[model samples]
Target: MIGRITNQQQLVSAQRNVQTSRALLSQLQEQAATGRAVTKPSDDPSATASIMRVHAQQRATEQYGTNISDGTAWLATVDDALSSSEDILRKVRDLTLRGANEGTMTPATRSAIAGELEGLKSDLLEKANTTYLGRTVFAGSSSAGTAFAATPAPYTFTGAAGATVQRRINDSETVRVDVDGAAAFGTGTGSVFALIDNIVTDLTAGTDLSARIGQLDTHVSALTTQHGVVGTRYSRLQQAAQSNLTQSTALEAQRAGLEDVDPAKAIIDLKSQEVTYQTALGVTARALQPTLLSYLQ
Candidate 1:
């Protein structure tokens, strides 16, 4: 025998189908409006997880890019200071060359040259004590306000030694963006200031200047070497910046692929769900309609 059919069961099933179709239609509409495939984790757990991972990586890459930018700026300031120092040293070298020709010069001429050399030495000290955002770049890791002092017979390095300052541009990468003033300009009586002071002393006293010329040459060479080092680090920071930008773009695309929805597909889905809901209503109506002509008979 066939089982009896129940109108209550049919009505309940039809209403459930209609509700499901309406819910699907609403979800498609929201996806189309927001342009996102996964509005909630429950919508697409796998895609949501992938999107979260990609987004986290993108955030980290952006932070690295910021670090690279900051490091690049600090290196640029260091380069400028070094270049200025070298220029000043070159001028002092020219004066040293002239003073070395003491056999052809008067005492007054040598004294004037000595005075100029003293002035240049002051300028060199200023350059060595250059600051970026109010912090001395060449002071190593010292908290001293400046890199050098002008007192006590010969200028002295006030900054500390034995440590370098660096910037972190990435997880596994760090770049030195600061210079050591003591290393670049020498410290205490052994410093360039003392060398210039000695030259001034010799020039004023009408003494031999040959050995001092060689010492000046050594200082110039040291500065040139430092310029090369800073240039290399600057180039590396620029390359790292470019690499970070590329990586960030790629990660953004990956996240978009995982989480963004195609409006066309969502629209099509919405239309199909609308038709399904209408069909459910029609079926439910026909199934629930009562035939009452037998009641009049």
Candidate 2:
């Protein structure tokens, strides 16, 4: 009776051990195949919460990268517009200087120069109305139509009076995406249209326009200064874009390390789990079989 009781207890213990090993093998196989420690909250509540947090962080990083890309594209368009404006302004300034010199130019020659100046003014106005992807770059927040409204008086800015749209590149950094049309093309005395009009009127009337030549020089100088400022801002934006790209790449790699499984590691773990499961099955099968007590002694 004592021997039988001992054998029964050993059988029960072996059965419990076999059940535990089977459960462990199942879990190990799932982990190796799916490469996830927890398939559901029931598997591991704490690990599920951790996975959720990492996913949220990865989404935020992706959004920030998108913002950087969009901001960079807008800044590039602005830079191109500014460059074209600078070239046009230089041409207008040269024409004014040539017209101002009375000794070499006849009245007819001055009139011809005035006509060319008028054409350039129209070109400048067209450039000021530059659009990117169907939206005006200088239109402030109102990009529904043209940035500068055209009347008989000349081109005039009709967009929002003081709305400046800014793009945030980082936590503490922001840049104005649209250059105010009034500020870039001028509002009162610094107005390009006014300067062109004054020169045209003076030349047509055959008056001493030499004094107005100085005004043109001043306008050109102011435009040059504005161009430099825009150019510098563009350069900074380019650098910021590059830095954001690098940061995004690093973040992607980090996220992959946290979430993506290495195939080699998974395969090795799968093989190990299979071996362990097979061994457990063999042992359990042998223990469950009838012993020599079944045969007559």
TM-score of each: 0.89, 0.82
Q: What TM-score, to 2 decimals, does candidate 2 have?
A: 0.82
Q: Model 2 over residues 76-108: C-alpha lDDT tens digits?
A: 787788778778878887887787777788878
Ten residues in sequence with the least summed lDDT for candidate 2: 1-10
Whole-model lDDT values for every prediction: 0.85, 0.73
RMSD of each: 2.9, 3.8
Query: For model 1, what is the alpha-carbon lDDT of residue 187?
Result: 81
Model 1 off-target regions past 4 Å? Answer: 152-154, 289-297
In Å, residue 141's CA in model 2 sits off its true spot by 1.0
Instruction: Kindly provide the TM-score of model 1 when superposed on the true structure, using C-alpha atoms.
Output: 0.89
